[model samples]
Target: MATVADGHHPFAFTFGILGNLVSTMVYLAPVPTFYRIYRKKSTEGFHSVPYLVAMFSSMLWLYYATLKKNAMLLITINSFGSFAEMIYIVIFVVYAPKDARKLTVKLFGIMNVGLFTSIIVVSHFLVSRAYRVPVLGWINVAISTSVFAAPLSIVAQVIRTRSVEFMPFRLSFFLTLSAVMWFAYGLFLKDICVAIPNVLGFVLGLLQMLLYAMYRNRKQVIIEDHEKKLPAATPDHVKNLVIIATLAASEVHPVEAQPNNRNDDGDVNNNAAITEANEHEQTDDHRHVENASVEIQPNETPSAV
Candidate 1:
């Protein structure tokens, strides 16, 4: 049977094309985020490290594609990735704060320029041709694995906050799909170097999905917590009724202490005779009418004294 232009099986070529399409979407995922940065003329505290590292990854993959045979798909996709990542980095630097911009530039220089150059030179000159591809392959694999794991920080944030606000489900779903597609492409192409990293990618994608499931009801979590912290409410009318009832009860059976006649007779005698006589009359009146009382009905308004 005939094969594709790269001598790859038709299925492999088809999957590679699918992978390219999906990965392209993944690469462009930050377009909206960057567009906001541009519109506001500020990075809004977004980090450029992801884009910088992405650019370096694409560059390395592009180099590896050139070194290997029949890797046109890899070259093409990674070329676009490199360009896209560079554009993202540029936008980030333009809008980032001064200190952030400086740090971004330094990171770009060290990783994209210095480290990438060093890798190419060392691999091309020091390593034998037979071993160069494997060495580069391993390096790409390590970096790609780290890239796959990078979103764990996001997972951690979600778990800590008990919220999926930071983890968009669409992104997670597509990334998982991309991993599956690329894994099949690598398998069909019989490329272990391409296949290895995607295994980790798929695992991370599933983890992200699991986390999304666990925290998707973040609003409910917040509500439950808020309810737990909130004090129970008392109705205004109920509180008013309670105050009125208490006052009525207190008036109905007001307690009054009598002066100790024996021991405090001198103190009582110091008061005016008229005051003492009035108090005795009041005490006698209270005793006489103690059984006669007004009942406080719940529905009745309290009467003024």
Candidate 2:
């Protein structure tokens, strides 16, 4: 459905401008995330799939805009998107850890280079010019829908972890608002392909916001409660034995020491006692009490467990 004739409607132009504004915000929403990656010098768990898919989507839209008339808005915004996503990809490649970098590079080659090139070739050579716009537009619709639904994984994470940290309210709000703006734009332009995906976008965005509300105050308390461990219970018998040992230890008096000597038969002779804290000196106020333990000389023999 080439909308060359109907696309110039005044209402369409107005909504298109609004769509451009909101969509630009949507495109740039990941700026802070990339900034974090840059500062930390690691990608952490953030995947390159979303940005790569987005870049491919924008490239597809750029080609679609080229084929259609009155598509300047598409061209202008997608040009900015293309540049922004490229910068993010470059930053990711630079700071990502070794394994993450390798995976990201592989995905980049496959999605942004190889797959995109194939689409371009097929659109230009195999597909007839008349059907090009429609075919490409549908492809974009599919990709856009996937982009909107990509947060399903995040939603699951939020639910499982009982924390809203995974989903940002500002991004969700912008996504929903952007959906509304673009939906109106496409509605005014009589372009169903543009209008269709935003319906899903708006719905999914609302779902995310509602989830944020439900668990925002909880702050992962539910999961943490389950993860927390209570102190192990002490047996009554163990407690009684500890009490007896402590009393017995507290009542003990100092023992006198005898000087070492060698017997006339040439055997070593010594006197020892089970006594000592870190050192072996007993005074009027001195006390050694560590689980009722006492140091014994090696010749005195070891204690049984």
CA shift of 153, model 1, Å: 2.4
lDDT of 2 by residue, 1-305 (tens): 22443357777777777878887887877787788878988765556656777787888888888787777777777888888888888898898779878988999899889988998899899999899889989989988887777667667756766777446687788878988987887887777888999999889889989998998988757534533421222343333422222221101111122222334333422223333432355542355543234676546876699
Question: For residues 1-305, could you state the per-residue lDDT of candidate 1 as single tens digits?
Answer: 11354457677778888888998998888888788889999875466776887889899999998998777788889999999999988998888899989999999999999999999999999999999998998999999888887776666656665766556777777888888887887788888888899998899789988988988977567545534543242344323422232221101111122223343456567666779889999999997676444454557876799
What are the clash counts of all predictions, listed in order? 0, 0
User: Any idea how many clashes model 2 has?
Assistant: 0
TM-score of each: 0.71, 0.70
Worst 10 residues of 1 by lDDT: 246-255
The lDDT for every candidate, in the order shown, is 0.75, 0.70
Give lDDT for model 1. Answer: 0.75
* Candidate 2 lDDT for residue 128: 96
lDDT of model 1 at position 188: 83
Relative to the unseen true structure, what is the C-alpha lDDT of residue 64 in candidate 1, on a scale of 0 to 100?
94
**What is candidate 1's CA lDDT for residue 125?**
98
Evaluated at residue 8, the lDDT of candidate 1 is 70
